[model samples]
Target: MPFFLRTMMKVLRVPKRTIFIVVIAFVLGSASIAYAIEPTTFHTWFNALYWVMTTMATVGYGDYFAKTVRGKIFTLFIYVFGIGLLSLVIGKIIDLLSTVYKHWEAGKLNFHGKDHIILINWSKKAQYAIEEILSFSPSSHIVVIDESDKHPVTDRQEIHFISGDPSSEEILEKAMLKQAKAVIIFADTRIDEPALADGKTLLIASSIERLHPAIHTTVEITQEKNTKNFRHVHVNDFVLSYDAVSRLAVRAALQQGSSEIINQLIRREVGDDIYEIPVRPEWKTYKDAFQGALEYGATLLSDRGDLGINRKLNDPIPEDARLFVVSDEQTYRRLLAI
Candidate 1:
């Protein structure tokens, strides 16, 4: 057996009850044999050994008896031993049952799906992001991977928590990296070396890309300078909190209802929204989709074809392109009807 198993067995092994039962069984068997051959010089110890094996194996032949006074005393002693042995056996069985139950519970929490969000670090911002994702899609499964023993998000049936260092390949594999929709690496702000934290996040992102090149990854960088180093990783999105916050503050002051508008726009699964949709062969230009959006009470934001590129809102659409449009489902359906 493995060392762990051996250790556990020693720690949780059955009690003295088992020994008592064995002794009792031996005594009873011996007594019975002694009684069967009454007046014969049959040794009690020899008869006990024979009887114990037979009884434990459930091979009673009914050829033995404990009719005499000495034999009866031996049988009484056997009963005591048997009871203790049974208790010990029962205790061991209970321990095994508990262990199996725990394993079953853990299995039920396994995550498997695409487009599902994987949050790397456990922090206030990450916690908020989780809440936002949940609010957008209540049925969406969010897996939190962190080294902390305790998770920040409250226990829920849908959320899966795996405690481990995010940078570890084993941990990432456990979180189902290849199958994940988007892996979001949150920089560990609690650490003194914020740049080192970002580096770790970058390494994790790069590892995922190398393992599964097609996988979409988004990373948060605490320092703006770190963003330049991450360019080689091909991360789909790079969110800089410092810059985004500063811009948001400026926009909120200049544009009335801009903060609320921005909040609704960024919030997933709510309000008049912009979402990516593949352009069909029939749709030739941005103008073609722009007209469709107008009819659907929506606006075409950008095209997936323009991803990783610097393009203006009014940029002409590529012939073979995918588009991002802002609209409600009713409007979306109507536009599709065109």
Candidate 2:
């Protein structure tokens, strides 16, 4: 059975008293005819039941008749009482059906499983972030939790959306927080109070941490100063939108193609881009990955352990590190000559 139907059945299950009343009414109404008519006429219980059904349905055929005066009176009671009971049953069924349908609609957007990203708050930037994540991992499942009535993205099976306050434990539980890989809280664009948005975000992060300490968390902040307050929450990453934009503007002023390069790096498309590959212990140094990248139409950017190559890179490939060019699997295989 469908979940909605099962729930409705549980809710609308007839009470013992109601069942007893209905049974009594049906039996009394049917037996009332016995007071006026002879039992010998119907010949069997099956025939009497058939007569009762036809009479209650108002589909009387002249084949069966109640000739006695008492039978006429019993027929009158059946006509009035039978119609009312039938209507009540129909109304209850309709009510149960409507309840089931509403639950079914809600169930469609419920999330499940672990290692999924949960995005709190809906905004243009959040939408862009989701698009970027999808571009890299096309099969990744995203659960969006927001208070908005409609989701910005078109309904796809891979994307689950729930409308509720992110700070609420009930809502977070519905988003499958325990199994989530990461939670990203977007700064609410409508709210002018940066503190309020950050508070909510922090509360959600704290709740997740309390429930599942190992889950990764990232939060977007409008003010750079508020970033310090979130340190205790053990947030994996924090994005100061205003500061980042200002820095980007400064860079764009000096470099003409800076913004384009950043865009291409974020979006997965045909381009030479930076990507992270897990280090294989057999590959002793970054130089091995560099030689591997030369064959694969890619460059070994840097090694995860090389602290010296953190941000400053004068050349495309860094020295003494292991970073592989990440493109399609075919390109990676061909480059490795595998």
Best by lDDT: 2
How many angstroms is residue 85 displaced in model 2 relative to the true structure, after the best TM-score fit?
14
Candidate lDDT (C-alpha), each: 0.69, 0.71
Over the stretch 1-338, how does candidate 1's per-residue lDDT look in tens digits? 69989965674553546645655665565556554645353455566556544544446666554567776665555556544444555666686688654543443234566667888887888888887788757888888887776545555766677777676777777778888888788888777687787878888888878887887788888889888778887888889967888989999989977888777778766687656665656555566666666665787776674543224434556665667777776676676665
TM-score of each: 0.65, 0.62
Q: Which stretch of 10 consecutive residues in model 1 shows the poorest summed lDDT? A: 305-314
TM-score (C-alpha) between model 1 and the true structure: 0.65
**Residue pairs clashing, model 1:** 17-84, 17-85, 18-85, 20-81, 21-81, 21-82, 24-78, 30-48, 115-181
Write candidate 2's Cα lDDT for 1-338 as tens digits: 59989966764576645844785579555854553375776766666666777776678986675667776777787789776565656676677688754543454356667788998888898888788778778899998887876655655667777877887778888889988888898888878888887777778778877887888888888777777778887887889878888887888989988977776665666464566565455545455555556566665554554545424443344343456454654565565554
